[model samples]
Target: MRGTLGIATVVLSSLMVGCGSNAELKTFTITGERIIVKMETQDRSSGVAENSSEDQLVANINAADEQEISVVITRNEGSTEEVTIASGTFTDDKIVLEGSVKQWPTPIDIYVSRGNEEPMKLHTALLDSETNPNFVLLDFESSDSEDRLILSGVSRMLGDDSDKFTISGDLSSIHDQNLSLAVAEVRITSENPKSISGLSVTELLLDDSKFLIEGIAGEPFLVAIGVSTFDYAYWGHVIVIVEPGAQIEISPSATSSSFVPGSFASPLLAKSQIDESLHRKVIESWQNSKKYLAKMDEYARAIEKAAQPITLNSDVLAVWDPYYVFKELQAIEFASLTSIAQSLEDPMASLLAMEIGALNWMEYSRKLENWYTLASVFEEDIVSRRVIPQQEALEKQLDVVTNAKTIVKGHSAPDFTLANLAGDEIALYDVLANNELVLLNFWASWCVPCIDKLPKLRELHSEYRNEGFEIVFVSIDDAYEDWKKGSEKHEVPGVNVGDLHGFLAETPVAYGVQSIPTEFLLNPSGTILDRDVTPEELESLLVDRFGDIPGSE
Candidate 1:
């Protein structure tokens, strides 16, 4: 079940070479034997992995450009455009790379390409100081030839740096010796994984359950506990400010999902206080809001059974009534999170505070400006440079969705055509021409809320069909098969059609469909009369127009 093929001979050496007048420059050298391995061969002809000359190996660093010609790190789905700190031609059977940087902790990416095609990433490392020369190895196993060749390796900051500060912690409380401890520079964006450097808990226990962290010190950092079985789910992180010769202690627990510092309590304790306060306040608010929501639901049912309109207490309208109580709870959390982030002394800590605030792109569009403003200030520090750019990109996406969602009532509805189940193109204008009003409903098959509203929509459609009312169901399903199945399964009663591109499709984007089950009532002239009309509101409006329900007394 398990086997090992020696693809490369890794060398161990430490040589500090000088580069020009850069006194802060640090040198890195990587030497290893390179061999090609094929996972799936129809004929099991070869006993060992094959070596081919067609495969090309290259290395890159996140530093100033050393070569005029660009060398981009091509990942599976996206490419990371980085400055090449070092460059060289690879020999047939070995990979030898030497690079120098003005900073000690720099990022390195190794890739392999074939026949002038895009380079595929093989490994990534956050190279830093180490006492002993670190060895690099990659292992992959697969029975299927069509499957992708998985690349696996571990990189760490293992060496000694005299100028660095140390943060020591005790793992005696944690009995799970199989866990892995990760210490990463706190980042605000998705690139946080790239900053991670890990150490084995079993190995740390060997040193008396005491873990030592020595890195580009005198800066704030975060530590997280990752379980081996879970592939290191983020329990939580504690902000530690490294002081020269200071012993900062951290207790990381998997069961409680807590990572707090015993020493240096200023930032961690403050964050804890903020989180605890927010939690208490949210619970209190949700309890009060639940009573009102329950009463309102009961009132809605009463009105539905009576098949008539009823006026409720006016006081209920003003109490957490501007929007859903859930929205109010989210608003409270984000406001408190912003306050906590602003109170932190370290930019990195502040960045991490905002990162874990659970802000979304489309839903929290209004907060994008403020987040961008905060990230701009954080990017002033060199340590935050690794993640700020990506954060800015995420915020930019929020801005785009925000702008798109701003399509309000009174605006002309954007018209578009799509294919239905019969492979016939149906235009919005054609539907508008026949019906006095059209409920243009944007939904997806995977959306539960979208499916939940279908029965009521069908009822309303049946009731109002004779009164020149029509419903057009637009599905933003990425797959045609899924769309066809969902449409047929739901027995969607409307002019059902799909663009099959999800939210990114033209019709969805034109109509600003950020969330599913978004509805717009368009008049025969194609002007949006209303948006986000609830099922109850739709019934009331139809009643007002048609006098009463046909079957109701």
Candidate 2:
């Protein structure tokens, strides 16, 4: 089933005067600069199809009035604190906002409220920062026939600054055209529909197999196509990146597997094809890599089974040998995906590279040079542009690897002062002074894996406490109650400290902890012996150094 091709032409227009009282006008003009927001609403209560005459559509828009609408502009610096710089009401068929905020390196949030309905918010980044004032015109129309809202917008700089760029495009779907009747509604959502902050619709228009969406140059957004049938509604998403002043066309296709059944489907999995051949190759490569992962998991499970009977120090060599097999499987998967990624194009290649990089970091985190090599791979070609978010995520992973490099075997451990459950400050050096060896374990109550390893940790601590072995369990739980509960439930021996800030805590960042259950083994001299050792490995090491479990001998 192929979606009908509908062209959505977005033409830049001059700002139009609004017909409203001056008292009703809320402006955000800063330094004689303003952003004009124009909304056009159409009444589709007559059960007329979207193919209605352009003149009729205009008449419907002009006939609409006194729609209660509100606008809010906010600055987002990718942090928790977001500043609302400007806000206004959309009375008299328009809203004009002005602000002195000159440049926005990060994207700003634009929210629109209509009547008592939930407001709609979209993000817009500054494409041409040199321009003094910018304008974004949002055109909204209600489709009473389909029970959905149609939204589109175009943004450009106000003056004759030629540095401005515009991105205009039409979206074509690969679903059945008859499914259009099943579309209950449509709206502009975030790039990830699962993160759809406001509303989820039952159906969206697919009659023409084409929908129009506009974005600022060099920004990405999501257009959700909803299909409601058999009393179930599913959303198919498409992610589009608008280039500077380019009319790049996008063809979005959805298969049975493309949708998440009852919920939202991610654009990443949505079989979008700008270049058919490249997309097919990407799909093939992705499937092949997934098969490798399945095999890896199979091997991992077998290794886990083989290692289950490791109780005696003598059994350590044989049972722990499966880790070599696990590493081999990981290597094979990494190589396979890396090869596929190298053979693919930008977005696909970048995605595969990201997967490979993650695996590499997890398996070979102690090898800093390997991380550098992976980072270099991510910096190449269009892949770099396509994987900005992924790249940003890699920073923490890279930091872990970099920190591992500095605190590798034989290096002196970094000292930290953390508060215990009793609110008393305990220094790492102070703990190391009395203990022959210290195992610093970073964990959280929320992490199931971390909690699962508590029994083994407690057993080891009980058996080795007299032999000068200390286990420092640092809780990264955000809530104090959860931390205290987990500590008491687990009966974690030795020192228990809570970092409460979780990953944002300074100690975890200093120790380069990307994930929980990270354990660091320090020797008597406070030198790092090993890091990220598994529970079994820790037990094996203790047994090897202490000769045997007290009762086992």
Candidate 3:
């Protein structure tokens, strides 16, 4: 939950002589004059999380010097061809790469065998490069693919549907004790809990009076304000949960429903048995949320130290400190308690609350779309002999506008023209002819995840290219020259495409793409698996599921 389980023990003590035998896979260190690469673990359990962490890579780093490190992963994904060297560095998300490698950057891919018979290749491109002097901020729609970028990684926020909401934002405000916000309520008609999705939340709406929330499941304090009663007439305080990305509308009062348009239906409407199981899960989650509230201070500290404001696509958004933000989000998810999580005095709590709230707007949040937007409002009144003027506060309005509307997953990926090194055009839909799968990857040359997985991507392309599988690499840079340079430097070969759309807030907005090195897989027929898939798992899935489509060529 708090990242991957494999522990990393830094060796500062010289006297503690330890053997490096894993017993399962003998690990030995190979040191060069300036680099140290450790090869361990022959058998990687597929059970490992989607992200196993590149923190302590196939190599170690000098603590004092921020040197540009490249890990070359050569994996054999059940094929005779060994996936060769591709450049990879999780820290690329940290450093700013330049020069030749910047001109022709590395692209990488993770390999997974059909079953467990073959060892999958993890290739990293090693190049003749120089020191990177910048901090990595994630330029989501960047065309450059560096060994690292500015900001990095995904936000881990989940929820459960009970007419409750959680909000996510920069919570470090709590460190300075600056965060002071009230939780909103969506009044429900019935006292029984209504089901939504993953995240947990406080019952701020339960009594119409907002109460101060505290401690998650395992924490010290635990006392209930409401009755610990169950509704036997229906199921335990449970309603059917919402679908993957659907909103659950529970009216606080039946009369209020008329104020809102359309009928409120939950995608997660389950059968009677499902409703019962969901009720149990919600209870477990509520109990868990109470316990996690104990460590609010620690999480608050992490959030405060991690936030830094930056601009993306001419839009100013606060970028939280990557490491601290990543960990704080994990704590909330694992705690499995949204309500208690929100009560946290720390800013991380608000971020969790906001994230969950956005997930279920019908029950948890107020839609920022209509209530607030880039749309301008003019309230003009004639004063005595003078006319009062009204102006559009565009930027202020845009920041608060939430674009969380239902977006269809698997149709033809929207078409957009992106350039290549030669300024040629490539449209997304043009690539989707009769192919079973198309991987639309939005990456920059500096992305640690992108660079690290390049070789594997090359391998997948080569292996499946003849088989009717298609993949395109989209760069979100403004300059085609820089894109060309990074592509050449990385030795990124194949259908490499570049989109000048800085961050297609419109395109990715149309498709709800928040994070990157994100892979989208579609059946040849293109239904919505919209499967949130990773590269390594994808390779295995393709080989196993389709097993080479008949007309694949």
Candidate 4:
């Protein structure tokens, strides 16, 4: 049973909501003249009557940390007296307070502060001894230094049926972020779990002071919200669970003035403490993986030297090995999610894990199949809508890779026309007709490996130009300016042409140039003689064909 301590040195009566008359009651008292609240529960019942020999006030708080917090009772706007009612630490992430006052239906403010930060007001509520017997107050502050849209406030379960819940809150954005709010019925689809067209979509107007959402209880549903600043929009969602007759509140403090968006940053997203904690864990893991990758070479060398011949861990080796690190890191980073998808009781949490894991599915094909299977039971449309359709297109590209391999060594080279820097149309056959052997190089300005081979390509062109050996650079840079800048920056030799459509450029796609620094050696008749020929291999082939021609350097 819930009870309250009155302000004066007198006994007071307390009332409980949705409870029988047989419910137990406990008496509370303030030390000396100050009010001291002791709570046995996190939920607080509203007080409806004043302390006119009959009423009391009580409250309970649930927060993330066991920090020191204070409760102050104050009069309406113009009053000067502020009485410190309760001050203590949160125990087991919860704080309960019970108190009574001479006056009922009075306003009170709760202040919470951490470390050296100034005390900030966390909540304000009106209390009476007999009316308004249930209420909530919650506040949250994100430690993430990223652009975010914060929605926080109170939620109360009405009546006894547990069929419906009401959400009322203040929604604010850092960086003046623009967002939209939508509520949808979550469904299990044949291919995956998804939400159909939203049941309702509302533009989140900054001018609007507060918002409310009334949703069905018991069944799982979705609250979709996203903020867009530029061409890209970041989305965060949560599946909320409210127990019957429970009043919960969570809101962010108004102190995020310098927050800025990073390349990978999104707003602080959570519908509950669980959501917030899990999201933070995922973000930390991602950051740690990036830090490891940046020092992969250093770590690999150190570990290789430290390991003895008979004791080296293959798993550790694989994690540091340049050849295997990409796949290994992805697996290690998302391993927990795969486990969650298989066994977590909360399907909403599992769905979140699976969605994040699917972003890099191609890197871990075995995990991809498992995730897809798991998604069939709990998939979401937010990311999958973009990923699933692309799978088909990428699978087709795989077939192109196979066909491309078949055309090498003996088959005729695929012919194409593209423009050179001088604005002249250059065709493969045309270049092949002029040179005895041609190195058809497919590259992009942004490809590090392609840029690394430039000096050797220049050397080969200078040495073999007189012997009918040519290097034709087919740039797949998506823009003409990038292609021109790269070619000039590298001082490329021989003929230079650009498809200018990036990897999707007609020539590169026709030749199945999935990855770069892809090169094909073709003869005068346009028949492919080699694929992926290294500079040393090209040198030896040239020596055999030209026998160290007299003018060669």
**Model 4 — which ten-residue stretch has the worst lDDT?**
2-11
RMSD of 3: 24.6
lDDT (0 to 1) per candidate = 0.49, 0.48, 0.34, 0.47
Candidate 1 per-residue C-alpha lDDT over 7-26 given as tens digits, one digit per residue, 9 for 90 to 100: 22121122223334546776
- Candidates 2 and 4 compared: the better one by lDDT is 2
- Report model 4's TM-score to 2 decimal places: 0.40
Number of the top candidate by TM-score?
A: 4
lDDT of residue 346 for candidate 4:
55
Taking the tens digit of each residue's C-alpha lDDT, what string does model 4 give over 169-219? 444543333322211112222122232212111322112333443333333
- TM-score for each candidate, following the candidate numbering: 0.35, 0.35, 0.31, 0.40
C-alpha displacement of 297 in model 4, angstroms? Answer: 20
The sequence of per-residue lDDT tens digits that candidate 2 reaches over residues 85-162 is 565554344445654343222223344344443444433322234322233332323321111122222233332222
Model 2: pairs clashing at backbone N, Cα or C within 3 Å: 4-209, 28-97, 28-98, 29-98, 148-185, 166-245, 183-203, 183-204, 184-203, 185-203
lDDT of 1: 0.49
